[model samples]
Target: MREEVNMPLNLEEKKELVKEVSDVLLNADTILTADYRGLTANQLTEFRKIARTPGIYIKIVKNNMLKMALKDSEYAVISDKISGPQILATASDNPGEFAKLVKKFIDNNENIELKSLAYKGKELDLSEIKKLATLPTYEEAISMLMSIMQAPVQKLMATMTAVPTKMVRTLDAVKGTKN
Candidate 1:
C-alpha cells in the first residue's frame, strides 16, 4: 500500500521557500503578467514553445503564492498586478524581445490579456509596455547605432578619395594655362 501522506511544512520551511522564490523573482531582468483564462491547452503549449527561445521562462502560479513570495521583495513592484489566474514570463536576455513576442501573440490570439509588466523592478504602464514591445532590442539598437556611426566615416573616405583627382585636374589646367 502507498505510504501515508506527509504532513505539511512548518512555518519556518514555508518562509524559506517564499524567500528563495522572491529572491529569484527579484533578480529577474523582466517579468510579464497576463491572464491566460481563455487560452486553450494547445495555445499555451505553442506559447511555451515560443517562449523557450532566447532564455524565456513561463510559469503559472496562484496569486496568493506569488504575493506571499513577493512581499517585501524587490519584485513587489508588480505585486499589485498579480491576481486571478495570472501567468508570468521571465526573460533572461533582451527583455523587450519577450515583451514583443507576447504582444504579437496577443495580437494574433485574442484570448491572451496583458495585465502588467516590469523591467528591472520598475512597473511599466500599458502604453509604455506597448512601446517597449515595438522597440528594437538592446543588441539591435547597438548594432544600428554602430552602422550609423560607420556611415559618415565611409562617406568622408569617399569624398577624400575624390580630392586627389581634383588636385591633378587643377594642376593640369594650370600647366596648360602657363603654356
Candidate 2:
C-alpha cells in the first residue's frame, strides 16, 4: 500500500518538535535506536504500554526531525543510524531495566531491528545493547555491591560480640557454682 504523505510541519511546529526531542536527549541516562517500520499498530500500542513505566520512554520519530533535534548533543552520534524510520528508546535512571524491556519486545518480533545504543558518551552496537540488557538493574547492582562491601564489617561485629557473650556466660557459670 502506498503511504499517505504527511503534510510538512510549519517552522513553529518543527522548532517545538526539535525542542521536545532535545529535552529527551538531555534527560535520558541511556538512549537506544531501532528500526520500527515493520511494527504493526497493535504492536506499537503494546510497546507504548510497556514503555510507560517510570524511567522508560519510547518515540517513533521522523528521521529528518530527529537529525535537526540531535545536533550539538551527545545523541548526534546516533543520527547516522536515523537514515530511515526509527524507534528511539530511553531510560532516565534505569538503563538496564529499559534495555531489558526493549529487548524483550525486539526478541518477540522478527521485524524489529536494533540499530544503535548510546550511554555515558559512548555509542554501542546491538551486541553491546544485548549485554546491557542482561545487566542487573541499577538498584539491584548497587545493593549487591553494598552487600559484598558490608560482609567483612558484619563478620567483625559478630566476632566482637561473641567475645563479650562468652565472658558473660563464664561469669554466670562461676556465680552458679558459688551459690
Candidate 3:
C-alpha cells in the first residue's frame, strides 16, 4: 500500500476554501457540527449519500479556515464547536429536516458524535437539536394545517345533512304508522 502524503493547502487555495464556506454560511438556515473522528471514509460517504437533499452542504475543513469563514457572520457563534475532527453540515431550507437527517445518521453510526448546532445565530445543545429533529417539515406542517382548518367545516356540513335526513326518516315512520 502506498502511503499518502498530506499536503498543506497554499494561500490561494485556503482563501478560496474560506470564500466557499462563507458563501454557504450566508445562505444556511441551520449549521450542525459533529465530531467525526472515529468515522471511516465509507461511513462518511454513506452520510453524504443520505444527506443528498437540495440546498444541503457538508464539508470537513480545517478549523482555522472555518473560523476565518465564520468570522463576522451570524454563524460566528459556531466557531466554539470547531475544534478537533469536525464535520460541518448546513442547509438553506427546513432546519428541522436537516436536524432529522443528522440525527438519523448519528443514531445509525456509533462512532460519530454530535457536537453542537447553530440556528439563526443561536447556539443549541444536543437535546435542543433532538427537539428540532422532531419538528415537522414544511410540507407536513402545511398539510396538517389544511386538515385542521377543514375539520370544523366538515363537521358543520355533516351536522346540517344529518338534521334533514333525520326529519325525512321520522316523517316516513309517522306515515307508515298512520297507514
* Number of clashing pairs per prediction, in order: 0, 0, 0
lDDT of 3 at 156: 100
Lowest lDDT sum, 10 consecutive residues, model 2, at 1-10
Model 3 CA deviation exceeding 4 Å by range? 1-7
Q: If scored against the real structure, what TM-score would every candidate get?
A: 0.77, 0.80, 0.91
- Write out the backbone clash pairs for model 2: none
lDDT of 1 by residue, 93-161 (tens): 776787788887888889988888778878878667677787788889999999999999999999998
List the candidate 1 regions with Cα displacement exceeding 4 Å. 1-23, 167-179
Prediction 1 TM-score vs. true: 0.77
lDDT at 165 for candidate 1? Answer: 84
TM-score of candidate 2 to 2 decimals = 0.80
lDDT of each: 0.78, 0.83, 0.87
The most accurate candidate by TM-score is 3
TM-score of 3: 0.91
Residue 24 in candidate 1, Cα distance off native in Å? 3.6
Worst 10 residues of 1 by lDDT: 1-10
Residue pairs whose backbone atoms clash in candidate 3: none
Compared with the true structure, what per-residue lDDT tens digits does model 3 show for residues 1-179? 12555877779889999999999999988988888988999999988875589878999888899999999679898787778988889989998788888888888999998877888878877778789888899999999999999999999999999999999999999999999
Q: After superposition, how far is residue 89 of candidate 2 from its true place, in Å?
A: 1.3
